[model samples]
Target chain A: MRSINAADITEAVANLFKQANYNLGADVLAALKKARKTEESPAGRDALDAILENTRIPAKENIPLCQDCGTAVVFLEVGQAVLIVKGDVSKAVNDGVQQAYKEGYLRKSMVIHPFSTRTNTGDNTPAVIHTTIVPGNKVKITVLPKGGGAENMAKLGMLLPVAGRQGVIDFVVKAVEQAWSNPCPPVIVGVGIGGTAEKAMEMAKHALIRKVGQPSPDKENAALEKDILHKVNNLGIGPMGYGGRITAFAVHVETFPAHITALPVAVNLQCHSARHRETVI
Target chain B: MIKGIILPLTEKDIKSLKTGDNVLLSGTLYVARDAAHRKMIDALDRGEPLPFDIKGQTIYYMGPSPAPPGKVIGAAGPTTSVRMDAYTPKLLAKGLKGMIGKGVRSPEVKDAVKKYKAVYFAAVGGAGALISKTIIKSKVVAYPDLGPEAVLRLEVKDFPATVINDIFGGDLYIEGKKKYSLAQ
Candidate 1:
């Protein structure tokens, strides 16, 4: 069995959070550059220019890309042959998040008793962790910091099995229309098809980690992604709703088999600040 | 080409502004978001004075990240304006003249803008770092317990924004969408 120290995991996660927030992903930057040329509205083009320029300041100044550094979301893929040494994975992950938010000066966005007192957690901790046991010996860790504006706009629909593809397209397009500029526009639409309700929601969020313009391997799913992107851009939400053709950078769809009679679909909209990073150890 | 605007926007200034006009706003504005808005409303309900005078003042719907060493403030940009809708009309009634934020506002907010002779401005969302460059000064004014959500007094120089709603019932989001929307 391959043994991995929990300290290493903690360090990796902390660095990932810092790097993800400071540096806008190259793919997202490229998409924005492309959008700047294609956006028809004068206001829309100006917004894109500001957004593209914003990408540079954070990296050069060693500051976060956005004020809303977001909730720490850690995804873990642990191989069956690997054994964690010295500490539990959950504690390590939380420690990493705390260290990163505190030392890196990222915003502490998490709050406890969310419905009631709504107290700030002081340090962004108790990361929302999703773990899966995989086949290899190495552990793959991915940090995805989800901002509240876009996350609050996430929607789920448990459609009738017969609702079919058109139903999904309509549902997703309508959701984006309703969300409008609230999700910050020029968003990445993540669609999770099939699976149970929660599973679909999780999958929807997971789909956002894919690089901009990357399509799903499944032919039908990829086609749906393309079609959804077209319909969404046609809504003319544009960059921050200044209004033009580029409402979304990409639409990513992930699917799994569902129980008969269950056609669960979830849409997780990602803001223009698509911050995420991954590491394998 | 952008118009330059000074803060403490007057009735004449509000009347001159229209939706879709890009402006470089300079001078003083207070920053507050969800938590601070709630507290301010509660203070109003108690017949208590707000920490800052509301008359002819503009409130920026933003919550800044903690500044790193040598910076006046961290990434300072506008938050979603709709979240402040619940408390806005009440604030507007108290003589608040302008608001800077991103995204669309509710019908009630638009109506309040017209009724109060106020204006709503939209900043580029997600451009926090760039926006921070415009903020020359910042300090917490109230509710220090709210951390990032605390109310802050800020001085800005040519902070970029677009007029989204105006005193004459103009709405940029509606006009922009109508201009580009292809669907019937």
Candidate 2:
């Protein structure tokens, strides 16, 4: 069995958080550039240009791209054959989050409670972490800084089995249309179908980790993504709601089998910043 | 397009602005999001003085990511404005004149804007990195315990943003969508 120190994981994840916040991923940058070229409205075109320019300036100067440095969401793929030495994995993750937020000067946006006594945690700790046991000895950690705008726009619906494919498509398109300029388009649409309510939401968020505009390996899912993209862009919400051809940069779909009588769908919309970083150790 | 102008802006300056106009902002603006808004509103409800003077000041709804080494701020883009609607009327009453953020405001906030003659502006939401260039300096002005949600005083220059809602009830989001809405 391969042994990995918890300290190493903590440090790596900390760096990932800082790096993700500092740099706009290449895929996201490319999409913004593409949007700038095809955007019809002069205002929309200009919005895209500013977005692209923001990416360049931040990277060169090592600054944040937006003020809503989102909640720290960590995804862990732990190898069953590997042992985490010297400390609790979860605490390590939180420690990493604390250090990164403090040292990096990132905004601490997370509050201790959702509804009651909404108090700031100060160091952005106790990250929302999800772990999966995988086949390899290597551990992979992904940190996605999820902002409130797009996260608030997320939705889930449990449908009857009869709802099927058409229902799924309608639901996703409607969600995006309802979101309009709220999620800060152009957005990356993540659709999770067939799982239970919470599971569906998880799947939708995980789906966003895929590179923007890349097709799913599943042909049926890929086709659904394309159709949803076409319909959402047709809504004409455009860039910053200024009107243009590119409202959504990509649509991603992930699915799992559900109960015999249930068909569930969840939509997770992410704004163009799409701040995420990953490391394998 | 209104050319770049520096901040510590006066009511006279932002008052002259209209919906759909492009402006490059300079000077100092305060950063406050939900947490800070709540505190400010609570203080007002208790008839206590505010942490900072609101007259002629612009508040940005953003909680930026952490900056890397040798940087003043991290990807600092605007957050949705609607979330702060509840507390806005109170702030408006205190002589606030302008706001910088993305997304729409509530009807109550809109009414406050109309009643108070304040303007709401839209900064590209996801363009954090680019916006930081305009922020030449930043310091926590209040609620330091609130961390990133703490109210911050920021000095900016040539910060790009467009007016989304003017004091006349004109909304750029509504008009822009109408101009671009595709036929069903």
Candidate 3:
């Protein structure tokens, strides 16, 4: 068995958390530049210009991209043959989160006793972690910092099995329309389909890690992404809701096998400042 | 060219603005987001005086990042306005003239804007880094314990924003969507 030190994982997670918030993914940046040129509305073009410029300032200044640094969401893929030595994996990840948020000047957004006490956790810790065991021996860690404004706009719909394709499209479009400018337009739409409710939601969020404007590899899923992209843009929520032609940067769909009776779906939107980072060990 | 906006927006300015106009707002304003808004509303319930005078003042709904060395403020951008919906009508009734943030407002907020003759402006939400350059000065005025959510007095120069809601009952969100949406 390959033994990997947990401290190294913690250090990598700490660095990744700070880095993800400080920089925009190259794919997201490239798409924003293209949107500026292609956006039909002069108003939309103006918004894109600001967003593109926003992408640059943080790198130069060494500042977090947005004020809302977001909750640390870590996805772990551990190889079955590998052993994590020296410490517990989950605890190490949380430690990394605390170190990064504290040292990097990222915001402490989590509240303790979620409903009643509502006290700040002081350090953004207890990262939302999801792990899976894979066939290989390497461990893969990805950090996706989800901002509240966009996250609050997330939705899940358990449609009737009979509802099928059109129902999925309509629900996704309706969610985007209802969300309007709330999630920050020129947003990325992530759609998860054909799983249990929670599983659908999880898949939908994971779908966001796909490169911006890239279609799903699966043929049917790709077509769905394309159709939803067309419909959502037609909503004309535009850039920042000021009435421009380009509303969403992309629509991404991810699916899982589901019970024969169920057709569950979830929609998660990310703002134009799409930030993510990944590392493999 | 960026149109200039003078702060402590007046009724005349409120009436003159329209949806979709991009203006570079300059002058003094205050900042507050969810936590501060909540506290202010609670203070109101207790019949307590507000932390600052409300009449004719524009409030920017934002909670900026921690400033790095040699910087006055960090990536400061607008937060969602809808979260502040519950406390807004009370502030509006007290003569809050303008608001700067991103995204849609509730019908209740729209009605309050119309009823109170106030205006809602939107700064590009994710463009915090670009937006911070305009913030020339910042200082906390109240609710220090709320950290970034504390009420701040800020002076900005050539700060970019668009009027999303105007006193004339124009909502850029509805009108904009309808204009480009194919189904309409």
**Best candidate according to TM-score:** 1
Residue A172, model 2: lDDT of: 91
- What does candidate 2's lDDT look like per residue over B1-184, in tens digits? 5656566566676677788889998888999988899999999889999899889889998876665677777767888888898899989999888899888788899888989988898999888777877788888889987766779888888888898888888888778777877764
> Positional deviation of A59 in candidate 3, in angstroms?
1.4
Q: In candidate 1, what are the lDDT values of residues B69-138, reduced to their tens digit? A: 9999999879999889999999999999999998899999999999989999999989999999999999
Report the C-alpha lDDT of model 1 over A144-237, residue by residue, as the tens digit. 9999899999999999989999999999999999998888889999999999999999999999999987999999999999999999999988
lDDT of 1 at B94: 94
* Each prediction's number of clashing residue pairs: 0, 21, 0
Best by DockQ: 1
What does candidate 3's lDDT look like per residue over B31-115, in tens digits?
Answer: 9997899999899899999999989999999998888889989889999999898889999998898999888888999999999
lDDT of 2: 0.86
Order of candidate numbers by TM-score, starting with the best: 1, 3, 2
List DockQ, one per candidate, in order: 0.80, 0.62, 0.74
- Model 2: TM-score for chain B: 0.95
Per residue, candidate 3 scores C-alpha lDDT tens digits across A1-281 of 89999998999999998999889888998888888888888878888888877877786796778888898899999999899999999999999999988788787788878778677788887799999999989999999889998999999999998999999999999999888888887899999998799999999899888899888899999999999998888888888887777889999999999899899999999988788899999
Model 1 TM-score (B-chain only): 0.98
Itemize residue pairs with steric clashes in candidate 3. Answer: none
Q: What is the TM-score of chain A in candidate 1?
A: 0.99
